[model samples]
Target chain A: MPSLKDVKTKIGGVKKTSQITKAMNMVAAAKLRGAQSKMEAFRPYAEQFHAAMASLSAGTGGARFPLMEVREVKKVELVVVTSDRGLCGSFNANILKVANRAVAELEAAGKKVSLVCVGKKARNFFRKSGKMRKDYIDIMGTFQMFNARAIAQDAAANFLSGEADEVRLIYGRFHSVALQRPEQTTILPIKPIEGEAGGAAAPASQAVYIYEPSQEEIMEVLLPMFLNVMVYHSMLEVSASEHAARMTAMDNATRACKDIINNLTLIYNKTRQAGITSELMDIVGGAEALKG
Target chain B: MAALIQLEIVTPKGAVLSEQVEMVTAPGYAGVFGVLANHAPLLSTIKIGNLVYKKDGRDDIVMVSGGFCEVSNNKVTFLVESAERGSDIDVDRALRAKERAEKRLAEAMAQKEKIDRVRAEAALQRALARLKAAGKM
Candidate 1:
């Protein structure tokens, strides 16, 4: 058993720790709200963009740009998004796990793999691995539109330049406050998304239309723009998921801290009671001995 | 009566407007054009100019930047780079921008370094459009 002083000091330390964790949890909660709202605002644009991509390219089988070409898989580029900060539960680790497995899988299939990391965590994770094509770090907390554009340009250039035969983006998908799942999406080839009603009907409607600018010109700008949107969308997801994961982790930490503080208080009280009883017994026994 | 067209104006930020309207007139890539209900499946690039729409017997104005417009099945969607409705535009800000743009244009002639002519021109156009939308032009 620790001395009363020691136990008292420990309780003070734990209370301070709990206060810090509680504050962190509150901060994370506030940030999560902002991030979640930002993500919510971006969802319609993504869905509309995908819908428009499907409908616009419906006229043709698919655009004939190099972006739409499916070549033999010789090299694969993975655009990996992770959180810039740690203490976000397993969010960044999950991303790293999925990304590492993907790289290994690609390599096992007799393909060369390169990485384009989007966050500090990803950059740090893959630092020892000599497979990074680009690492845009510290862009997760304070995100910018041009960051997405810059990333999209790099990915498109790699695909067009034949450095990468296929390009895939791996990131945490923000489902809810309690859940963020790591997901992978293939970005290159700009294929028409299936199960969408408008995409399939595009081919039939291509014949009887007046395209203001020619069909090919629109495809030239739209495909790359679509790629940029995808990158932007992924970054937005990372932001929201990071905040949510941090909030949950901090909340758990706070709860654990509370538990520890409770247990410590209980122990301190018992030790105090034991010390008081021992002192009273010693005084009573001494008085009785004096009387005898 | 023709079915109303569901017009949506979306920028990278988010959807600016989504409504069922009777008519829409936008500055297209080639020129300004108007669309009613049952327009054919058409796609056109939007130019930086004023977008005019009529709904509930009132005409409203929006300043739109470069983007694309698609019309299909009574739904007209304008995927724009940026947009601001007339009511949302700050008249003072627009006027200030106009003054700044004009000042820069004048300063460009006397400066030794080459001025970004395109940027200044775009700024001027955007300010003009905003002022027009706010009914201060």
Candidate 2:
């Protein structure tokens, strides 16, 4: 039987842990709100930009730009984005898993693969992978559009310089608090986003558009801007997903702690009752012996 | 009364404004252009400058950084990197940014630094736009 003192100490430790988890949960919740709002606000801009790109590409009718040029896939660069801190249950792990799967698939196809890790977690995870082209650390907390621009520029440079034939960005996409999944998109050699309705309907709508300073010139600037926007958008999604994952993980931990404390308390009470019952039995026997 | 066209200015940060206006004037890549209600559909790249719209027979300005403007279906939508309403701009801060950018540009010129010069020029443009939007320039 465990002693009361040991039970008491165990309960105290679990309680402290629960307290910490609760605090973390609250902090994550607060941060999630800010990140979520930022993501939501950016959605309109991204959507409009996409619509514009779709129409422009449709109207231009095969206008060739360097960024939109599809090249042979001899070598691939993966920009894996993950959170800097760990403790969010499986958030970073899931992203790394997807990225690793991608790398494996690429390598299996006789293509060379390189990595550009965007956060501390990815950097640490892929530091010894020998395929690391570059790693950006300690930038997730207060990352801005400029950070994304820098990363995009690096990827573009590598692609243009023939160091890599293709560049892909992999990050967690935040759908909701309960749903964050790893997703990958090609950032270099920009693919014009077709309208969701269908490709057939896109061209008809493009006919009425008038371009300013010619479609070719507009595309020269738009494609690079598109690349930058994609990186920034993905970064925003990852930020929101990180907070949501942490919040959910901490909440689960707190609930589990409560269950543990309850179980420990039940055991403790049973032990105490057993000790009292044995003492009563001993007293009764002593009285009986004295009377006899 | 002039026909009112829907005008919306959006940035990566958020949607700054959506209102019915009599006319919209934006700084296009080629030059400044104006659109009224029922204007033909057009897409154009815009530069860092003031975007003025007339609402209630009064002029309201928005400081827009580089992005795109689309006019369609009697609506004008601006997708800018950053935007500030004329009323929302802090003139003093804009002035400070202008001075800082000017100093950096001068230093870069003296040192013959290409990269810093470009960045300083961009910053200077943004500050000037803000100041212009606020009618301080």
- Leading candidate by DockQ: 2
Per-prediction DockQ comes to 0.46, 0.79
Highest TM-score against the true fold, candidate: 2
Question: What TM-score goes with each of the models?
Answer: 0.84, 0.93
Off by over 4 Å in 1: A108-110, A141-144, A195-208, B1-5, B20-22, B54-59, B90-137
Clash counts per candidate, in order, are 1, 0
Error (Å) of candidate 2 at residue A50 is: 1.2
TM for candidate 2 is: 0.93
Tens digit per residue, CA lDDT, model 1, A29-72: 89888877777777777777777666566665544777889899
Candidate 2 lDDT over residue span B5-115, tens digit each:
999999888999999999999999989999999998888999999999998989999999998888888889998888899999999999999999999999999999998
Q: Write the per-residue lDDT of candidate 1 for residues B42-86, one digit (tens) a residue.
A: 888877799999998899999997778988878898987679999
Candidate 2 per-residue lDDT, tens place, A80-133, comes to: 999989889999999999999999999999999999999999999999999998
Tally clashing residue pairs in candidate 2.
0
Model 2 clash pairs? none
lDDT of 2 at A203: 70
